[model samples]
Target: WLLFLGITLFQIPRIASQFKEENWHRISETIPVSEGTMLLTLDTQAEDPDFNEVSLKIEGTADSLVTLEKEFFSRGKTKAESLENAKVLGYQVSVLDSLVSFPPGFDYSAMDVFRDQKVNLILKVPYEKPFLMDRSLLDILRNTIYRNGYKSRDVREKNIWAFNEAGLVCLTCGSTTDETENQDPNEDQTEEEQINREKLDSLSRAKFRQRLDSIE
Candidate 1:
């Protein structure tokens, strides 16, 4: 009985840690920054039902190299299977040259099953380096407020932003003194807002198609 109690106590910490890790799968990757402006976009990817929910946060890091942080929750019948789910999700983020593009959601076909799959992306920019988020991304950049004391939806997308000694700052916001911490990623979204964003995306797609047809 004594040995059993000792063993159980020893295993408790490991069990707790495993439980925590299982709930939150984290992935970090280093993106090579180009000499000038870097562009971020996910708008080009067509939205699919399998992977429809995604949230992204833009942050600044002093690390020099551009860092992309990803977190998600996935489940399976066993720990090994769950890890495999995470591995499949990790493969979906593709960075090409100065343009870093990630899907609004992951591809479910590769994931095997959907276990409350949610992907949250954080794009970390280097200090004083310029970056722009494609206007189409206004929907996915959720629960995040900008450094100029504004939220993603409120800021004008055409201008550039960058990280500096004070954290994230707008290169063209005109006023540089405003700085605040980013909001929590867990904020809830309203059903009305979701519907509106879907409409906007559909309209953007239509406009893009029209432009292509006119060119041809």
Candidate 2:
């Protein structure tokens, strides 16, 4: 006797279309994430955490990558297999060049083995209201690689994701960049002039506040 099992895989186009519809609000806004949006929550107290004192974890894995650090001209990179043991706001990241040694029994010629597989970076930031700026961090990483004359697809890949409380997860890829162009000629003023202006503004504000406090 022979038995046959029917299998159906979800359609990618449908999934993508549904996602766009669901996130239309975010996609339409010039600045979807507000300035005060919580990017990461640094809790100093958590029991039996991987880092023991602090742990860094993201809400999703879409922002995870395995990439080379040198290719990015980045100085911050460290090896990490689990966010459970990472420090919150940690700068030590993992790079691809350093991960040449895979675990034993793992075949490098596997079908899903992305040639640039090692050039991936995974960052787990705490869940915050704004998680990050309006733009994703992956864009920034890609731009940096491109600016350095390195083909992003050939070099390393960077992923920045966020995680929130209640064990919810979300992932994203690429970095973000400000699209705003300065219209004010003063925008390019000398650093000294800008510093002086800021100092004067602070002094004036301080005087006004002091006068108001006295009346109260």
Candidate 3:
């Protein structure tokens, strides 16, 4: 390695130009959306740091297909060489049934040299489709607006949200970012609660008077 480094120093200008990043390749794929699925969960955990960085974006689409897009970059003497180098793909997507276990980043450990390879996942779905975002997706979800003025990360993980024309919206009470429109837990009364309230109110006159006298 040292000998190669020393040899390259003799022709720094020519060698450096040979390794300049000059080309990028793009790819896009679409998949059909499954039926009867309402909830989508994102895996919060990230993959190994050594791998190339991958970014994710999700949006509501009138169309029923989910799209995955990627851009791979490489340094080469010619455009064809760069294209051929970037053609080596190694990432995988895991979207089975309801539970999502996909890795959060792209894997590039097997590849030689550093190629500015990037992957962008575009999950398209109908409006009002519910989802649970992991805290890790904050970087990708910031652009998305939620019902009211709540930030995407501000909503709790347990809370479910609907991705609609309006953006990310809280579907449940606990998931709301603000106190507005919050209903009181005691506002609704059941038969047992009514009976309990009546019992407390209908104290005997003598006992009520005695209690009042004691307080006085």
- The best candidate by TM-score is 1
Model 1, span 88-160: residue lDDT tens:
7643555667877766666556766555566778888765667777776776776445433456543556555
lDDT of 2 by residue, 1-216 (tens): 122222223455543432231100000101122232233222222122221121121232222232222111111112221111121212222213212211111122222211112122223322322233222222323223232222323222222222333222122222222332211224445778555544543443354346547779
Q: lDDT of all predictions, in order shown?
A: 0.61, 0.26, 0.54
* RMSD of every prediction: 13.9, 20.0, 16.5
Using all chains and alpha carbons, the TM-scores for the candidates as numbered come to 0.60, 0.19, 0.59
lDDT tens readout by residue for model 3, 162-206: 444434445553434455453222335566764553343233223
Q: Give candidate 3 regions above 4 Å deviation.
A: 1-15, 18-21, 31-47, 139-152, 173-216
**Better structure of 1 and 2 per TM-score:** 1
Where model 2 places Cα greater than 4 Å from the true spot, the runs are 1-8, 21-189
- Candidate 1, 204: how far from true, in Å? 33
lDDT, model 3, position 208: 34
User: Of the pair 2 and 3, which is ahead by lDDT?
Assistant: 3
Query: Any idea what lDDT model 1 has?
Result: 0.61
